[model samples]
Structures are given as structure tokens and as C-alpha cells.
Target chain A: MIEFKDVSKRFGHTVALDNFDITFAKGKITGLFGPNGSGKSTSMKMIAGLNRPDKGEVTLGGLQPQESKISIAYLPEIDYFYPWMTIKQAAGFLQAFYADWDEAKYKDLLGFLRLEEGMKIAKISKGQRAKAKLLLTVSRRAPYLLMDEPLSGIDVLTREEIINTLIRDYREGEQTIIFSTHEIAEIESLVDDVVFIEAGQVKLAGSAEDLRINKGMSLLEIMKEEFRNAN
Target chain B: MPTSRLGMFSKLYSKEMRELAPEMITVIGLAVLAYIYLFFKTHDYPFAVIGPVFMIGGMAAFLPVISSFKLLSREWKNNTVYLMMSLPVKGGMIMGAKLTALLSEYVLGTLIAGVSGFLLIYALNPELGQVLTSSIPGIGMKLIELWPQGLALYLTSIVIIAYIASISFFSQMVGKLVSRFSGLVTAVVFIATAYLSGKVGDLFWLNIDKQWFTNGINTFDLNVINQFLIINLLFSLALAAVIFTLAVIIYNRKIEL
Candidate 1:
């Protein structure tokens, strides 16, 4: 379980997270739906231990994020692999640090994603890089999988592959996945729960099925309506 | 599925070495080329090679310090720092690997320059070894006779390089802690740290015990010079350790993406 209790973060005078409070339960795929600059990446980075809250605390399984990083596999929206590294080299480097890395699963995903292990990450297309990021993240059987905007700016075909990989690789009762994106429709069927955020605060949140049944609208429609109402 | 600690650290060390290899090779390559040029051009004017060799030696020493500044900052510049920060290891391990890599650059750079310079000079004047032993106003000794002092000087140079690398790492981390103007912050911190440490070193020299040097510098004894080298070496190693620990603390606790 990951908990953010009264977390607030700032850069200069801009508040990235404002008195935010949320908890991601164990063994569920949760979506953080928000527009750009709504602090989705900030929240994800906090859990990845890349960012720290200025006013509050974030904990994973009662341990600080730094202490629990071994259990979390994070796929940032941007390309972060060393430019000099081929996918195979990157995998080998990561393997040293992550005990949960599954070589067979990694190989299978390489084939499934149509990525050659020898291809240099810097030489690949943006879509292929996105797939490569997903490949690295899912190869690990980490307890917490945080994908921050995994499909943002990716071509439709590549997004399909990424979503397909997520659906195929997800272990229902063992893995807790927190996915943040504005493209909620792409992952709507895959997310069990959704949290709608605006201006660094949760505007609404509930089970995906409950939101659809109670509101009589799809997640996309609900997002539009909720943001319109807040405005 | 578990990996040993040594295995992880070695992997990290190898990666750092690979990343810094290009810079090291570029500098060393320039030195080698210069040595080759001097090996031919300075046949008639032997001592003319001294200026260029000394200049290259200075460059070989300074390039690593410049490279050390980029060692941590480049990860951020290339956005690979995200990958580095996400690794599930203590900050000490990351820092240790990088420090060792930078130190390796210094060691390799200096050794190549020193050895090549000595060989080039010896090649130019084959009787230079004998000339050194027969001459010199006071210290009439062969090059081989000064091995003890030579070793002390070599060790002192390494400790000095380690000290400089540690300060560079410390100051770069300080620069990165800020959200803007990181380069400026790094320069300021580096200058400040180096200045303060130099003062500390001066204080140690001024407060030195008389026991080690009861018979002062008028004698010009080799043992006195060795002792000074050893003292400087020990002081440098201690400061490097202290500053490196501070860097590790900043990396683990304070730095943010």
C-alpha cells in the first residue's frame, strides 16, 4: 500500500501538490486522471523516490519511498535510459539492481514488442522507445508498478501494444499498479479504479465500474463533466 | 534471483568507467600524439620538448578535474539521472563507483604522461641517467637512488587527485539541489570548499610537530621530504574521506529530480 498524507510540494512559487491526500490499495490497477501540470508526474516521482514532499509524507508499505524502491518498478513518461546503452545492455545493468527481474519475461516482451535487444535506445523511434520503457518496467515482477503517462504522445499502434502488454502482464492479486494519464479512454477497461485530479487535488475518485453505473457516462465523459463543473 | 553486493557495485563501476572512457581516451590520445611528435621533432633541440611535455602534463592533470565536474551533472543533462536516481541502492554505492572511476581516470592519465615523458627524455639523451647521478649541487644521486622519495611523490599526487575529485562531486551535488542556476551554484560551492580546505591544510602545516623535523630543511635530507609528502598524503586522504561522506549524505537525503 502506498499512502500520501497531506502532501504538498512546490517549485519556487508554484505549488505542484497542494495538501493532497490519497491511498493506493494493494493488488489493484488505479488510474490517476488529470490534465497536464495537474501534478500527476509529481505524484508518480514521489513514489519513485525521485521527488520529495515539502510539507507531508509519502510511504510505501509503511517504509519511506527510498527504502521501498526495490519493490517498485517505475516507467517515466520521458526517455531516461542512457543513450549509449542498447536495450540488452540496459537490461543487464538493471538486472544487477533488481532481483525481481525475470529474464524469460523480458525476452518474451522483447519479441512481443518487436524490439531487438541490440537496438540502441537513442537510435530507436519515439514509439519504439516508449515500448522499450514498458518492456523494462514490466520485466520486473515488482510489487508496485508505477506508469506515469505511459501512453502520452505515443502513436496509436504503439499505445495499443503498451496497453496490451499491461493487460497481459498484470498479475491480478499480487501486483499493485498506479497509472497516471490524461488519455484515460485508452486504459479505461484496464483500470479497476480511477482518481480524477485537477489543480493538484483529487476532484473525484471511485471504482471504474461504480463511476460508469452511477454517473451514466464513460470515464472520458466523466472527466470532461467533472473538470467542467470544477471550472 | 538475488545479486551479490560486490556484483552490483562492480556493474556500476564498469558502467561509470565506460561512460568516462571517451574523455580519458581523448586526453590520453592527445598526450600520446604529442609524445610521438616530440620523439621526432626534438632530436636536435632536446630540451625544447620540456615545454610541450610540461604543458601536456598540466592538461592531463586538469582534464580529469573538468571531467569530474561533468560526471554527475551529465546524467541530469541527458535525463539519465532519472534512471540513476531510481536504482535501489544506497547513495554511498553510487558515489563510490563514480569516485573510483574518476580516480581511475586520474591514475591512468598521470601514469601514461609520466611514463611516456620519462621514456621520451631518456630516449633523447641516453646518458641522462648518468649525468643526473654525477651532477646536482648537493644531492648527487642516480634516478634509481631516489625511488623512496619518488614513490612518496607518486602517492601524494594520487591523494591530491582524490581530494580534488571528492570536492568536485560534493560541489556538483550542492549545485544540483537547486532548481535553477545549477551551474553557477556548483562553481560557487566548489571554490568555497576548495578555499576552506586549503586553509585547513595550511593550518595543519603551520601547527606541525617539531619531532618529525628536529633537524630542519638546511640539511636537505631525503627523509624530511618523504615525511612531508607522507603528511600531505595522509591529510589529503582524510579530507577526501570527509568530503565524500558529505556528498553521499547530500545525494541520499537532499537531492531531488
Candidate 2:
């Protein structure tokens, strides 16, 4: 679980997150949906302890984000690995820091993703690199996994592979996964909860089915309608 | 089982050093080739014997300084700081790994250079050892004569080198802080700080000499030299520590995009 308490972040004159307050519960797949520059990534970064809020606090479970960092795995929108490192070396490097590293699961995911262990990450295509990053992240078996735009820029089949891989490999009872994506159709059926953000604030958040039943519209349709009304 | 923090730090440093191994080998090879060429061309130049040593040692010390600069800059350019910062490791630990790698490269380079220098000198001028033994008493007298000036110069050089390294490290830190504007700002700040520090140093030295004018001029006191070296060493270490601390604080608190 993660909580942001009146957290605010600013860049020069522009506010990236404005007094934002939200909580994400555990043991569910949560879809964080928003247009570009809607503070979705910022919120995720704060939760992962990669970025500090300018004011207030961001907490994971009962501890500060940094204190809980080892328990959380983060996949950024554009993940960058050490260029000189092979996929295996990268995984091994990560394995040292994390107690929950599952080597068998990592190998299985690598095979499923069709990623070569010896290939340098820099030599891989963007889609393959993204998959490699996902494999590295999910293999950690952390209690909370925060992924920002994991499916973006990948081929349709690769995207489906990624989605299916998450569904198949994710341990449902104890683990929680939160991902932010603009591609709602790919993740709509997979996510149990959804949080919609706009202009640095949470506009709508609830269970996916509840949003459909209460709003009387598909998640995408409601998002479009909300943005249209805001403009 | 989890690696201890220091063990993790060492592992990270080892990885960085391995990444830099190709460059290290190339530089060392080039130095050896140059030493051989110089030996063949001008056998009399003491450098024919010592050249390789100094070249290698200098490169060992200098290359890491240069390589670390490049490594840190490239991380910023590639936006890899985001990934590095997101990891569970402490900010200071990340810096420690980098500094350890750089220092290890420097030490290894120095050793290669030193060994090469010693071997070449022994091979070329085997009689140099006899020369030193015979001249020891006279050289001791000469050293006593020049002890004060020699000590001052040696201490000053050490201080200057430490100052340069600290500035370089600070430049990398500043680059991270300013991001896109890092290069321009780093140059400007480096120049400005260097100029200001030079002026302040001149003023401080003038006061020291002025206060102890007669003693400074008349005292060939070996004790004076010892004192000066001790003070210089302390000053250099303090400055390095402050710069390193600043770097750690910025790294720990500042968010990477």
C-alpha cells in the first residue's frame, strides 16, 4: 500500500503535483490512467522513492518511501540499463540488492520474453529492452511493483505477451502491481482498480467495474468525456 | 543471503573497473610502446629509464580523474541517473562505488607505471643504485640546504592536486544539479571559484610570510618543513572530505528525472 499526504511537487513555475492525496491498496492490479503531464508518473516516482515531494510526505505501507524501497520494484517509462552490462549481469547486479530475487522465475521470464542472457542491453531493440526491464523488475518478487508505461512503444503482440506474462506469473495473494498507461483497452480487463489523474490531481478513482457501472460508460469513454469537460 | 553494504559497494566498484578495463589496457600499452621508442631514440635522457614510470604513474593518476569525469557526465547525458536513483541503495553508496572504482584504476595504473619505471631504470642504468649510495651523504647535505624550499614546493603541489580533484568532483555534482545547463555552469563556476581561491590563497600566504618574515627566511628548520607538510596534508584531506560530503548530500536529497 502507498499513501500521499497533501504532497505537492513543483518544477520552476509549473506545478507537477498539486496538493495531491491518494492511497493505493495492496493485492490488486491498479491502473493509473491520465494524459501526458497529468502527474501520474510523478506520483509513481514519489511512491517508488525516486523523487521527493516538495511538500508533505509520500509513504509506502507505514514507512517512508525510501525506507520501504527494498520492498518495492519500479519500472520507469523509458528504462535505462548500464550499457556495458549484459542482461544476465544486470539481473545479477539487481539480485545482490534484493532479498526476494527469484532466479528461477527470472530465467522463466527471460525465456518467455525471448531475451538472450548474453545480449548487451544497449544492443537490444526498444521493445526488447522494455521487456528486459520488465523481466528484471517483476523477477524481484517485491510486494509492490510500480510500472510506468510498460506497454508503450511495443508491438501489439509484444504488448499482449507482456500483459499475459503479468497475469500468468504475478502471485495474486500477497503481491500488488500498479501500472500507468494511456492504452486503456489493453489493460482494462486486467486491472481491478483504476485511478484517473488530470492536471496534477486525482480526478476519478475506483474499481474498474464500479466505474463502468456508476458512470454508465467504458473506462476509455469516461476518460475522453472527463478530459473534454475539463477543457 | 544479502551482501553487506560494503560488499555491495565493492562489487559495484569492481563492475565499473571492469567496464573501464579496455581503456586501461590501451593506455598502459601505449605507455609501454612510447617508453620503448624513447629508450631507442634517446638512451641518455633519464626519461629513457624513468619516462615509462612517470608516464604510467601520471596516466594512472590522471586517467581515472579524466575517466570519472566522462563516466559521470555520460550518466547525466543518457539520463541514467533515474535508474540509478531508483534503486534501493543509498546515495552515498552509489558515489562510494564510483569513487572506489576511479581510485582503484588510479592505484593500478600507478603500480604498473612504478614497476615499469623501476624495471626500465634497473635495466638501462644498473649503476644508478651505486650512484645513489655513494652520493647519499653529499645528497643529504644538499637536501638539507634546499629542504625548506623543497618542502614548500612539495606540499604546495599536493594541495593543488587535491584542489583540482575536489573541483572536478564538485563539477560532476553541479552538473547533476543543473542537468542541461551543467556544462556551461560548471565551467563558469570552476573558473570563478579557481580565480577567487587563488586570490584568497595569495592573501593568506602573504599574511603567513609577513607574520613570520624573519623566521620564514632564516629557518631552514627541518621541523618547519615537517610542520608545513602536516598542515598541508590536513588541509587537503579536509577539503576533499567537504567536497565528498557535499556530493553525497546533493545525491541523497535531489531527485533525478
Candidate 3:
């Protein structure tokens, strides 16, 4: 399980996460839904060991994120691969760093995502690059996968492909995925649990189905209702 | 494929070397042009090439320091710091690979400049070449006798370059911890570090100076010179290691992007 205990992080005068506390259950796809500046990305970064909390702690299975990085696979929202690398070359480079990098899985995902091995990262379309990022990330059989805004700025068709890939690759009892995004409706069916956050605090949290039934609204509509009521 | 620690390090080192190849190639190309120009000018003024030859040698020594300034900063510029920081390796491995690659560049650059200079001087002015290659007659030392001193000097130069590269790494890592005027901070940190290390190095040299002229003899002893050079080399290497370790700590604990 990944735990964030009373964690608070700030940038200058902006409060990114204010005494935020949450726990993402193991082996479940947890949706971290929030609007802009709601600290969704910050939460993911904390779990990935990319950001440090100013107060309190973040741990993965009793170990700090830095100590357990080998068990976590992180895919940031921005493009992070080297521009000079072709997809194949990037994979080759990354394979050396990750012991869990599955070449067969990578090859299968490359074809499924329709990404060419020879495609230069700099030359590829944004949607294609998104797919490439997903391919590299999912190729590793990490216990925890933290993907921040995986669907943002991607076209609808590309987003559908990504969602489909996640559904296909999720190792039900063995993997935990924490997805942070504003596109709640897109992954609505895939999410087992949901946490709606506003101003860096959990506004609503429950099983996806339970939340829908209790509110008699879609996950997207529930988020709008909650934010509107808060305002 | 499962990657061992050494295997991963080799891959990282190769990546750094590849990123630096363009600059290395450009320097080599310019040096070649300079050498070719000197070859033709040799007939007009035999000793005219001396200045340009030394200038090339200086450039070879200076290029890696320039390269070192960019090695870490460019990762942020390219947004590749995300990929770099997320890797499950210690801070030492990442910076170590980069340091090794920069040192390799220094070695290759200096060798090309040094060897080419010797060949050009030997071909254009054989008498000067003989004087340089042969030992001092008054000292009664042969060329073979001076080999250890030459080797010590070469190794010391390598250590000095490595130390500069480590400082560059340390300063750049410090610069990245801020939001504004990062480049200026890097420049200040670099200058401050270099100045402080030079002062510290002087203290060690002072102690060496006492034993430098052994047994109250004013004559130059090759053994003492070699000993001094080795101590200098080890001192610089130790300092570089210390600075490099500090940079790694900052990288692992403080840096966020």
C-alpha cells in the first residue's frame, strides 16, 4: 500500500498540498481526480519520489519512495524521453536500467499501440509520443504504477487506445495503478476506486460504483457537483 | 534482458559519450584544419607554428571544462531530468558516468593535440625535436631517465581536469535548486569553489615544499619532483571525490523538477 500521512507541500505562496492524507489500496486502479492546481499531480510525484513533502511522510509498503523506486514505474505528464532517440534505442537504453523490463511485452505493446520501432521521439506526433510513454512504462512489471495525467492533451482516439491498453495490461492481483487526471469520464469504467480532491484535500472518496449509485450521477457529474457545492 | 550494475553503468557512460560526440568531432575537425594550415606555413617560417601549436594544446585542455558546464544543465533544458532522476540508481552512478565521459573527452583531445604537436615540430625542425626528445646533457640524464617525470606530469594533468569537471557538476547541481538567476548562481558557485579549492591545495603544496628539496640540497632531484607530482595528483583526486559526493547528495535529496 502507498500512504501519504499529513503531507503538505508548497511552492512560494501557492499551496500545492495542504496537510493532505490519503492511502491508495494495493492491486486496485485508483483515480485521483481534481481540477487544475488541485494537487493531483503533486500527489503522484510524491509517490514516485520525484517530489518531497515539506511535512509528514510518504511511503510505499513501509519503505520511503526513494528506497523502493525499483518497485515503482512512473510516467509523468510531459514528454521526458531524449529527442535524439528512436523508440527502439530508447527501449534499449531503459532496458539496462530496469530489471523488470519485459522485452516481449514491449514488442507487443509497440505493435498494439501502432508505434514504429524506428520512430524518432522528436519527430513523432504528440499522440504517438503518449503511446510510446505508456509502452515504456507498462513494459515494466512494477508493483506500483503512478501515471500523472496520462490522457491530458491527447486526442480522443489516442486516449481510447491508452485506456484500452491499461485495461489489457492491468495485472489484477499483482499491480496497483494510481492515475491522476481531469478526464474522469474517460477512465470511468476502468477505475475500481475514486478519490475526488479539491484545494489539496480529499473532497469525496469511495468505490466508483458506490459513488455513482449514491449520487445517482456519473463520476464526471459528481466531481462538478462537489466542486460547485464547495465554492 | 537483466542488466547488472556494471552493464547499466556502461550503458549510461555510452549515452553520455554519444551526447558529447558532436562537440568532440567539431574540435577535432578544427584542430585538423589548423594543423594542415601550419604544414603549408612551415616552409615560409619554420618556427611560426610554435604559437599555434601551443594554442591548439591549450584549446584541447580547455574544451572539456566548457563541456562540463553544460553536462548537467542541459538535462533540465531538454526536460530529460525527469527521465534521469526517476532512474533507480544512486546519485554517484549518474554523476560518475558523466564525469568519466568528460574525462575521456579530455584524454582524447589532449592526445590528439600533444601527439600532433610533437610530430609537426619533429618534421618541420628536427634539431629542436632532438633537443626536446633528448635529456639535458649537463644533468647526464638520458631520454629514458626522464620517462617517469613525463608520465607523472601527464597523469597530474588528467587529475586536474577531473577535479575541474567535478566542480562543474557540483555547481550546476546547486544552481538547479533555485527558481531564478540559476545560471548566475552556477557561475558564482563555480568560481567560489575553484578559488577555495586552490587555496586549500596551496596548503598541501606548502607542506610538500618543505620536503621538496631533500637533505638541504639545492640541486633538482628527479625523485622529489616525481613525489611532488604524485602527491599533487592524489590530493586533486581526493578533493574531486569529495565535491562529487556532495553533488550526489544534493541531487538525491534536494533536486525536484
lDDT (tens digit, per residue) of candidate 1 on B1-257: 79888988999999899989898889899999999999999899898887888888888878768878788878888888898899998889998998888878887888898789878888987777777566455766666777787888778887788788889999999988887898899899999999999999888887997666766555667778778778878989999999989999999999987
Order by lDDT, highest first = 1, 3, 2
Clashes of 2: 0
In candidate 3, what are the lDDT values of residues B157-213, reduced to their tens digit?
888888899899899989989888999999999999999989998887777658545
**Which tens-of-lDDT digit does each residue in A109-208 have in candidate 1?**
9999999999998899999999999999999999999999999889999999999999999999799999999998899999999888888887898899
Candidate 3: tens digits of C-alpha lDDT, residues A147-201:
9999999999999999999999999979999999998889999999999998888
DockQ of 3: 0.78
Best by DockQ: 1
**CAPRI class assigned to model 2:** medium
Please state the error at residue A39 of candidate 2 in Å.
Answer: 1.6
DockQ of each: 0.83, 0.56, 0.78
lDDT of 2 by residue, B1-257 (tens): 36567667766777778767887898878777876775676667654556556756677668876776776676666767766777778867877677766766665676676667666776777776665455345234443455566656655654555565556666667765764687787777667656765676566557655545456435544566566666666655566666667767777776456
Per-residue lDDT over A2-117 for candidate 2, one digit per residue giving the tens place of the 0 to 100 score: 78888899877779998888888788889999998999888888888877889989887789988888898889887578887899989888887888899999999999989999
